[model samples]
Target: MTANRTALVVRGGWEGHRPVEATDRFLPFLRENGFQVRVAETTEVYADADALATTDLIVQCVSMGEIVPEELEGLRAAVEAGTGLAGWHGGIVDSFRASSDYLQLVGGVFAAHPAVPADEAPAPGEEYFREHVIEITEAGRRHPITADLDDFTLRTEQYWVLTDLLNDVLATTTHPAEPGRPWRRPHESPAVWTREWGAGRVFVATPGHDPDVLDHPSVRTIIERGMLWAARGSG
Candidate 1:
């Protein structure tokens, strides 16, 4: 018999690339690979007890907002008991900054958008959403989720995150400021990582800045395997 796996997908915040678009792309991918998927456009997952209890995985696509405490607790309970939690870009890690507990749960926060500078507003030319090559860090190559993948190009927001010494560094990319660019510095940053929280697992990739970018082979493979591994946990 095929094992039944369920995932609750929550999508919202920052309508730029459209969270729904990203969820739409992944929901079918999960279903095709043997998962029953449920989609929510709001933070309702943070409330419904029955919905939270039955899920085997939680996929968040939210950017930033306030989450209800009960819902947060419910998710915490479900995951701690072995449910998987996975997401990309701002939807998972950078979504809820107001809640310290939420930040603690997700493992990191948005430090800066290299494409979008601090002082200047994002105009047409100022944005860095072009196709760029991403070299997998040595650690990433060893991780099951990223192993076997080659260096690939993606047209997405390369996220620079501020972490608190807990994540298992899996992959990274370096950003050096150009002479004509907005800033003046070079920082080698972690692009992906995994961490364990109780009986559950968490995997994050900072490169899913756009929906189309998810179509790349290297990108899709990491996300799919990461989600599956995070859901299964030490299995």
Candidate 2:
């Protein structure tokens, strides 16, 4: 059995994403997998270096929240010292928009999600969001987090994110051109990816908009394996 592994879950932000509900779904999974789970509803925990020193993995869910400089530094230091950081959707990438340091560590930015034209757009969370397939990349098929997983389709908010080559993209989705938008051509974005920062690993998947999506078999499996793959001393 894995010995005394600590899983720190920091979650809270926009209620639209149901941070509490989403993270709760995985709490048991973490415990079942031999994690000593601790829950914090704020980013202030990131500022505690000593606390982070013992952490095996961090599951963050602060969607579009603000993070101070010292907190970001301490978090980076902990990760660089071998603590794993893993998260999904706006909870990770779209967080702390004001902190580019966080962006550099995570290696992706939340750009925009394509919506239907102004005139035809329905109330939020309706048909405006597209149903697209998530295609696993060659690299993903070989990665522990996504190995043996086939491409699947889900209807939720499909994120059109901005990413750099520093990310090892595991899955991708195409954004069809919206006639009235700034861009008129179809473009692709990374749906799932991982990055190695210093001595640590960071994993992100862009599929969890609603709590239900977090329960999707494919989404849940990827995230579960991802958290393990990013942990310190993990194979």
Candidate 3:
């Protein structure tokens, strides 16, 4: 019966992150789980207070875009009122770069990604994709979302994020030491985390930059479980 929950998935923004394709990967899983999913390509849906009020979950995939004051407020209020918020990569955490309130609500923000190799840099508009390893933390091994998921290698951007201490971190990745890199020490950045906002729950994963990343069995399983856990507010 919990699978009968309502879910609103908003997708769009900088296409380099493959928002559309990435979001598509999870559609079947959501439907199979009994979610009555509604797909929206714009952030304007957030301004529909009535719709948001009744929704059980919100899955956002927008990256590096602006959200209007009204729209942001609507989303904030919805989540605060107990509507679960779930997302990965920039869609949830990297969105609304100028809104500190949004950042606080999501509990993290994408700070940077390892710079691209000089020869691989895009011709201005393309995204620079890279690869790295993601490891589940000792705590993650015990969390429902990531429990039993093995450490895996991913050929996607290793996101360096600024996170809130309130987050319940489930997984992490260490930045490899490189000369001229901003971090002197190998920083263990959060790869997955969850937090509570008022009566609602928030689930975030730093992977999913590319659709193929989500296609990985381990990554997909974590995401699938995270959606259900966040919506139900329990493991």
Candidate 4:
């Protein structure tokens, strides 16, 4: 159904998030779905007008990095012109921390994660990643990207994001009251959301911090569906 469509994957910045590994996890799936994929390791490609002009979707895996003015403008233009943008975790939502325009387009920004214990840090074998349950909102069950998916639990960073009210929130996770975790206001946060920007569609899932997290069946399915939903030519 995705035949003849083009997908550009841009991965870089903050190796701690394992951007390359995370982005690679979905490459084969995109290809199998009939997308001609192009990958770039830097944001410089975003400045290339020709490249953005022909791209159908952009799956960005860049974490904290500064995008040059020209490049940022180009990216905004591409998506404004009907190209789809989709990503998970720091790659999409947490990227370009200083770019307000980018955050507005994506509709959310990572604020913080549960703080680690200062005194009793878990050793090598002990589980350090926090486990949280994500529940699908009533609206999520009616949305194409999340419909038919059940709520699930994941052990990963539960992102605290500042979101725009315009976003169509699909799923959410709550901040559990635990040691060193004093969440100020509402505990529930958007786990997945979709928004419209100009003629483009934007999809975001905040559950992926590790490649293994993306391997989860529900995570994989939602992201795949989001990508397809974002693609212009894909049915």
Residues 1-235 of candidate 1: C-alpha lDDT, one tens digit per residue: 2437888888899876579888788877788766788888888676787776677788888987668888788777777777788998888877888888777877888887656454456667448654456777787788788888887876667777877678888777767775667657877677778888888888888777776667777778888888888875336
lDDT of each: 0.77, 0.90, 0.86, 0.89
Better of 2 and 4 by TM-score: 2
Return the lDDT, model 3, position 230.
82
**Between prediction 1 and prediction 2, which has the larger TM-score?**
2
Index of the highest-lDDT prediction: 2
How do the predictions measure up, each by TM-score? Answer: 0.87, 0.95, 0.91, 0.92
For model 3, the superposed segments whose C-alpha errors exceed 4 Å read 1-3, 116-130, 233-235
Predicted candidate 1, C-alpha RMSD: 3.1
Per-residue lDDT tens digits for candidate 4, residues 150-232, read 99999777788999899999999988666555555558899999988888999999988887889999999999999989887
Please give the lDDT score at residue 104 for candidate 2. Answer: 89
Ranking by lDDT: 2, 4, 3, 1
- Candidate 4 residue 95 Cα shift, in angstroms, is 0.9
Clashing pairs in 2: none
**Leading candidate by TM-score:** 2
Error of 3 at 148 (Å): 0.7
Off by over 4 Å in 1: 1-3, 116-126, 130-132, 180-185
Q: Model 2 segments beyond 4 Å from truth?
A: 1-3, 117-124
Ranking by TM-score: 2, 4, 3, 1
